[model samples]
Target: MTTYLLKSGILLFIFYLIYRLWLENEKMFLFNRIYLLASLVFSLLIPLQLISFEPSATSKIISVQLDELAIQKNSQSFKSLAESLDLTNIILAIYVTVFLVLIIRFLLNLFSLYNKVLRSEVQFVKGEKIILINEPILPHSFWNAIFINKQEFKNDRIPSELIAHEKAHLDQKHTLDILFIEFLQIIFWFNPLVILYKRAIKLNHEFLADAVVNNQFREVTKYQSLLLEIASNKTNIILASNINYLITKKRFIMMTKKESPARIFLKVCSIGIITSLLLFVFSCKDNPEESNTKKQNKIEKSSVGIEEKSTLPDEDDTVRSLAGLEIKPEFPGGIEEFYKFVGKNYQAPEEEGLKGKVYITFIVEKDGSLSDFKVLRDIGYGTGEEAVRVLKLSPNWLPGTINNKPVRTLYSLPITIQSPD
Candidate 1:
């Protein structure tokens, strides 16, 4: 889970950097909107290994895997690891707590907007339903409904430009985009990049609405003045698209600036090239069959037994953690069979009453053999050595894989020994 989050965060940072450097200031409002949305979506999907390509022959070989697996232990009853309040459990508890709080806040905001809609008077103007609320807040739109001040509607003070802006937001379905980004924020609340993404998405939405109003009215100076007037009024609704969102110098400049077709085409081509490079760097993997054949050849050449000289390259023989593999290494008949095998073969040292666990870790090699035994923790009286002896006698395991190619994975086991008591 940590590895996935790290990859996702890094991808998001890079995509956002691209936007800030090239796309953010351009006059292509619609294209910029699409780019921002696609960046967020691709940032999520690329890390999941969804779009894979064949690794190039000239590319240097690299292995991507977890550095450490969550520590687990087995006892008489095989109790869950969650029973202990370790550091991982504490961190998970905090994360879930924050997630739930954000969810509740989001629901409350939606309900508040819904309750206002239910109580307010609805009037249809030019085939669009407008909700007239008795509040001093600026105008906003939520999914197909335009909200305006009730007094302004009664006194004929609401400007057509404001109504047109809100309608543009509704017609373009900007609220759905806001909701999607809001949900992503809820999931990744700890990530600062997600916060920046929310701001970018909302700003682009305002740009789209502003473009519509400018084109409709054709009076750029008048529209800019009206935007300055509306910017003074405050909005409390976070979920709705407000008319006065971020009326900054950039928004004003974007309204009048124009780009040539050639420059636009060139920028888009550059984005494509960058995206292709990212996909190749992060998603491509070596051919599984070719990797397996090479491993076999290495094993055949090794006169020293498989126990001493591994098939992996001397310089790049890094053992991956179990959590990183697509398919986890397992004993011949799964974990229960492993327990039985250990119980049958293990000779417990002659101690009066040993009532603790012996923790052992080993590397499961590509050839389904276990090596590099390590005793992390053990009871006294040769109990740890006895556990290693039993593991060495056990049968070969099913090797783990990354991108469907076999790789060396680290495995940890804890044996519970309770003498006759």
Candidate 2:
């Protein structure tokens, strides 16, 4: 979800920039609207395809123990807190809480609009519903209804241009675009870009309506003049598209902007760039098959009775962790018995005044013998040395395997030492 939001935001940002820089003032209002909407949908979908061209396996297996730590500290105080607080659950709880809240808010807005419709007098004008309400508000449109003040309608005070604009909005079904972006906002409420996306789409709806009205009348100045008159009158209904001045200036500017066929190339280039970036961002996965193959070869060599072994380039070479293992190593008895062994043998470096945990790692050899014990972290006072000493004295494990053959795997543990009273 995080990756999807991130890629979506980046794409939206870039596409929005393209609109502002090259297409906003062009005579391609319909193209611009479709471009914005399509860009948003594509951004969301692009991240879901995990299409990486990279191979999964390698031949030379190198240990990656230090990349991700797997500490096994058993200090009851710290252990209880860590186990009780699951990060994934906490994040999920927060996301669901916010999502539910947004859903409730959206439902409330819809109900508010519906209640307004119920209270208003509906007049069927030329096969379309023209809803006249008692409130002193500018004309707006929602769904298939054109909302206007009852007094304005009765008094003939409503301008024909305003009715035409709202009617154009209704005819185009602009409400669907608004509702789509609204639902998207609810899902990605955490991302600020969703808010911007909602605003951009709403503004585009107005642009499309203005274009339609002007085209019908063939009078851009008169249509913009009508916009100026209704700029002061605003409506609080969230779901309705109210004719207001908040975006009227931009609408006025866009009405006068000339066509730019030449700059269409720039818009095309911007889209291409965004697509390429999204592809690179989403197509990534780790290749593990290489490491798996090397372990299998070594296991095969051992089964054939080959005593001589190939030397690693360094001590860190060939170590595989529990994550890399097809079958994890186990103590002769199970995890509980392994803990009991640690409790019996791991003495705290109390006399030396050790006061913190020491992380120790060792390789479980193909034969199940623990070897190459190393200290990953330590405090002073022989704490790390003490942990390593106890680990060296521990018995062999039931080796981890790949494809039913025992393979060398790395195991990590943390031992904490406390000060003596």
Candidate 3:
């Protein structure tokens, strides 16, 4: 969720900066706005693909034990060692727990808010040739079908425009959007992307609602004046922005500033954004893959393996390679148990090697078999084969998969071989 939000935030920020520049009537710079849209779509619709782990809809308490870490066969052992080396994630874990609590609390708040809105009395009033809902705020009376403070309508300064505006909110199903955005924030609380999402949705709603009210009044001047007049007041139950907030000022200015917004600019932006979105959707995205050097070495080794396909490369017939069999782990313990499986069966190569390190890359197959092992960082012929030799005798490893279906994994083993004759 954190990573997704960050990705979304970066995209949104570009869009925002571009939009802001557009607002200022200046040159616009657009980056990959599609990333933001893709992120938004994925966050709301395809969260599973975007997220690293399945986020529990309901919160769960996490237990910590430095002594007993869960391990999966054939998984990397570095995680435990790294965590033990650094205590930062311990604090992050606590933060993550608190964040979950916040999500739960926010969800409950939404339910309460929804119920309150639903239960509010609805009444319509048509008097003095105007339409308004009398919401049961205080000093209530009839304006339209909704009841609100009668004195409010009676105020000599009361512009009928505000009523139409609020009514438009109810009529256009805007509250549902607010509810949706609130839920998103709850889920992606730590993500600054959520903040950007909130802002975007709010801005869109205001733009939409403003348009609705303007269409009804027909007198653009009166509506604009009304917004400016009320720009100093307090409004309760606002989703994010207060009625009299800074954004409100921009909104009011846009409402008043009669100008033909550059259709060309909006068009160009739309084109650029759509193009970027396409790239984001189809690109070979960064989920998890080997580093460039390792990938290159793996490719080279694969080519070598193809050429040497007929030979076993060593005389150790008693040590048959387990590299080609896929072994299922009893439990998926992530990465620690993976290395434990390696450690359990692998004999550390003799220290009296030629050079600094012998790095071999190998594939752990679906049947818990290891095969196609190749030297990535080679010390020499002896150490290179030694790396493969030790790996060949490795215990049947835990099979890995992408979506619960078994898949072959390429792993690199780097060993420091000391120089001694």
Using TM-score as the measure, the top candidate is 1
lDDT of 1 by residue, 262-379 (tens): 9889999999999889877667655534443353354344423453234332322222122235777778988656665666667766555556656566767888898888675566
Better of 2 and 3 by lDDT: 2
Worst 10 residues of 2 by lDDT: 311-320
| TM-score of structure candidate 3 | 0.60
lDDT of each structure? Answer: 0.74, 0.67, 0.47
Weakest 10 consecutive residues of candidate 1 by summed lDDT: 64-73
Ranking by lDDT: 1, 2, 3
Weakest ten-residue segment in model 3 by summed lDDT:
315-324
The TM-score values for the models, in the order shown, are 0.74, 0.68, 0.60
Q: After superposition, how far is residue 140 of candidate 1 from its true place, in Å?
A: 0.4
Q: Put down candidate 2 lDDT per residue, 1-421, tens digits, no spaces.
A: 4445665677777767777776666767777778888878877876555354334553312233222212232322333224434766798899999999989999998997798889889998778788888978888889999888899799898887788888988888888988998888888888787777677777887887878877788898877776776566555567887667265566788787876667766666766786677576455433344553454455345434544243111212233222344567777897555655665666554344336555566777877788887665566567678667877887888887755877666555655554433
lDDT of 3 by residue, 269-320 (tens): 6756754663454332222222323344434664455443322122111011
**Top of the candidates by lDDT:** 1
lDDT of 3 at 69: 25
Clashing pairs in 1: none
1 or 3, greater by lDDT: 1
